[model samples]
Target chain A: MSSIDIAYIESDANPKVKRWKRLALEPRAVKRERATLLEGLHLLSVVLEHPKAEIAALILSEEAVSEAHELVEKLAERTGARVYGLTKRLYDQISPVENGAGCMCEMAIPAAAAPEDWREADVLYLDGVQDAGNVGTLIRTAVAAGFATIAANVGTASIWSPKVLRAGMGAHLAAHFVENLSPETFREHYRGRIYAADARGGRDLFAAPDYADGPCAWVMGAEGPGVSEAAIAVCDARYYIPIESSVESLNVGAAAAVCLFDARRRRLLKHG
Target chain B: MSSIDIAYIESDANPKVKRWKRLALEPRAVKRERATLLEGLHLLSVVLEHPKAEIAALILSEEAVSEAHELVEKLAERTGARVYGLTKRLYDQISPVENGAGCMCEMAIPAAAAPEDWREADVLYLDGVQDAGNVGTLIRTAVAAGFATIAANVGTASIWSPKVLRAGMGAHLAAHFVENLSPETFREHYRGRIYAADARGGRDLFAAPDYADGPCAWVMGAEGPGVSEAAIAVCDARYYIPIESSVESLNVGAAAAVCLFDARRRRLLKHG
Candidate 1:
């Protein structure tokens, strides 16, 4: 598979192509069996930015090789991974999305280092945020805000799913993720100023306890199911992002961005 | 179709149903539809709060109807929408998402008013963003920030798509939207102000023009392909949301939320 020769695939019937395309079928496909497909130059590069990101293969359309000539070289040269060029028809079959960005990278969500680095960090624990897009966007916000790690529980979508890998737009590289979390496990490993965001919470997130209150860890629940009783129970305090009377709640991803970034503001203020 | 006698679906395989279910296939499908396919009482009720939200129809699993006897009648009476009782086979077919939440509603994205309303009002124009969920969330933010209307140009997804409808939640009731815009049309009828959000803009979105500069517009382009040349050219000013070092851009929706609400903070000062 490591041969640099372009393995052109024109038919949608290609076995690997069909399997790659099927990755888009669910937010976090339990396709635990298949190699996760990564798309777009931005995300693939993001994964490569992280040392732990594993590269199984580089699956790209032949046209992508010709068009993004420079990117193709950098990707192949850096990773030492297999580069297989498929036909456009097969690429579509391998594409998780419709706008087909012309490339896909097969990678593994390689095991993350234990929460050791996170011992002195602020974390985001996601409980069953099943939407892959939301999970991905939150990861982007988390990375941009400088969160070191994010843990997603069993019910939440895997951070490595094709859609999330795409949505994170390579933010996945900026952060580390561990999946298959249970509330107890999250509370057990994460020692920090834990705050749960709920619309009905007593305090506002903006004026939340300073990050100096300890190694802050904010837990957000899924969109509809919000933080579970387990999550709510484990939290040190509950904080809410106040909204104008115009809406009931901000979308979960948007809410997380607002809260997570606000948490970062504390560090920025103290330092700068 | 209006006969309320029996619970029925016109076909074993209907295109719209397939489309609805197709959304469940992709992680972003529901978000892309601009309509979240909400199941159960919680979200359906959350959305039903905003005025003018249309519940296209309702589907109840036969088992669910039996267990929650009052649900069917309650939903039908409250929403003036159709109710269908379905066996597991049909119910499973009708349910596009994994968390079928027992009951579901096909929420509608209300149509926008004519361009006349946007001609001289504070409008938020989406120049090129193609993400349905991003478009929807921005609309929600625009509505919250007190923008009177939203105008989405070509290259943006239809606001009425199910995903936007759901993302905007009930923002359709708060603001208005008009699709397929042209720069000439905007220049001719729009006289107040236009601010294009870009990395290299003329002004800080945090410190925008005064409220006396009422009825302005903020035009946002697709993430990668920022505001169109014509759209950017027409703007009276360009506003940048300052970011920390190492960051390239803020998610369009997040930027909109911050900027629009900052402008909205004016209403308080003006009318205070």
Candidate 2:
């Protein structure tokens, strides 16, 4: 690789600093197609695997360069990204959440077509899942369990939010995001069975058709009030994740993991 | 049944308030043999399921009593415990955390015995998992997966922290806790083959030993930095939960669900 072009950002007012500030703090930066942010080397590796991920530039606190010596060298070799170093104070001002990891890269929103078969694959519809971390983790598990896509309701956290990006670890590149889903509209677009994961349910999870059998839709609600009654009433089934005698319910994030992987295991056994 | 002898608490400065305040913000409140706090009718239901859990006094906010009339009445009719109603404003002041469900009961912490045959079951060993929410959720999942007897290291969250209590959704009653374990100590007490849930050098979780055959313990670490190096060194084996193509890791709470359940499913098939 040619000698890396290094730039220094000494003030929060610097154009690069302002850009990263939104990347860290504002959800619209990612949602509005202005920019998306990825932090840490592991996540960057995930971006590299996505053939179309348009990584715009690398940004780091000066202290981060020393802390992430190997990563700095490697990003230069791999992405040909111009590394801009911000002073520690400037970095702190630009960080969106309290503990922003040392390394982040500004990326342009990739032009992606919605998966054509979103309605056919076993899928997850996030209805007002406000917590960024929960939304992200759900996407990651959905992917692991072989769900083809995620459809988000209007009030759900933006797919590009930093907390979600960090918690998701890096599922954004692999998973598809379809926004603006109301219960009535979503039902019309899909032909398969629909099940809402709610506490009060008609069946145990094991009783549901094995996920490998065919297309199914699994809907999860918000953390507090859970899926709206209108959504639950419309579902063909509501299955409970049979908790042990002592637990009232699993955390929504944990619940999704149990349900998603259960789907995956069923498929693996059927196919293998 | 005779009408219950209930007390009304209209004053904010009541001695009962002072007593619960200690349990509210303090971790030691539950550890000390004096008193513990339990909230919500769902939680109280979990407590009453165990005969050993002595119900001292029930605290219900007036607003909740009016709103959750059926639930409050059910709890009152079911137990010998006295119910006290406090006005909404006073209840807000006594609330341990923000926007609570408005039900708190003083109950006795039970003395739990280790399962006689933990060595033959799927198990989870938590090492210094400091976040109470994470710790509680882990225990809940371990129990949900049908594993018994989870122990915590000294550095981890107390098994009864309020955040964890809420997160576990009432799992503390069933889970067995062992305090302050070193790797050497864990080795001495547990006969199971220990598996460290590590990303590096770990076997694929989807292909691990069947949980039904013999003793197995899955050890998990704090967020960010995985398990401690010392703990990692003692693992008889290491295994990782497979994520999607780009995701690096799932949330620790979610990860526990995937691990515990995967092991449980394999074990179930083997035993059946």
Number of the top-ranking candidate, with DockQ as the measure: 2
Q: Model 2: per-residue lDDT, tens digit, A118-199?
A: 7676788888889887788888878777785888778889877767877777787887767777778778777777888887
User: Pick by TM-score: which candidate is best?
Assistant: 2
Q: For residues A1-272, what per-residue lDDT tens digits would candidate 1 score against the true structure?
A: 23255556666677766666666565445246535777776666555566566677777775564434455556777877766777776676667666555666777666654767675677888888888778877777766666658887788877777777777777666676677767787777776767787876658555444644457877888876688888888888887765667666777776776666666545655564
Candidate 1 chain A least-lDDT 10 residues: A26-35
Cα lDDT tens digits for candidate 2, B200-231:
55777775545435777888988778888888
TM-scores of chain B alone in all candidate structures, in the order given: 0.78, 0.86
Q: In model 1, which runs have C-alpha deviations exceeding 4 angstroms?
A: A1-35, A45-54, A62-65, A68-70, A86-94, A98-102, A108-110, A181-192, A206-215, A265-271, B1-122, B144-148, B180-193, B200-216, B242-248, B261-272
Cα lDDT, all candidates: 0.68, 0.72
The number of clashing residue pairs in each candidate reads: 11, 1
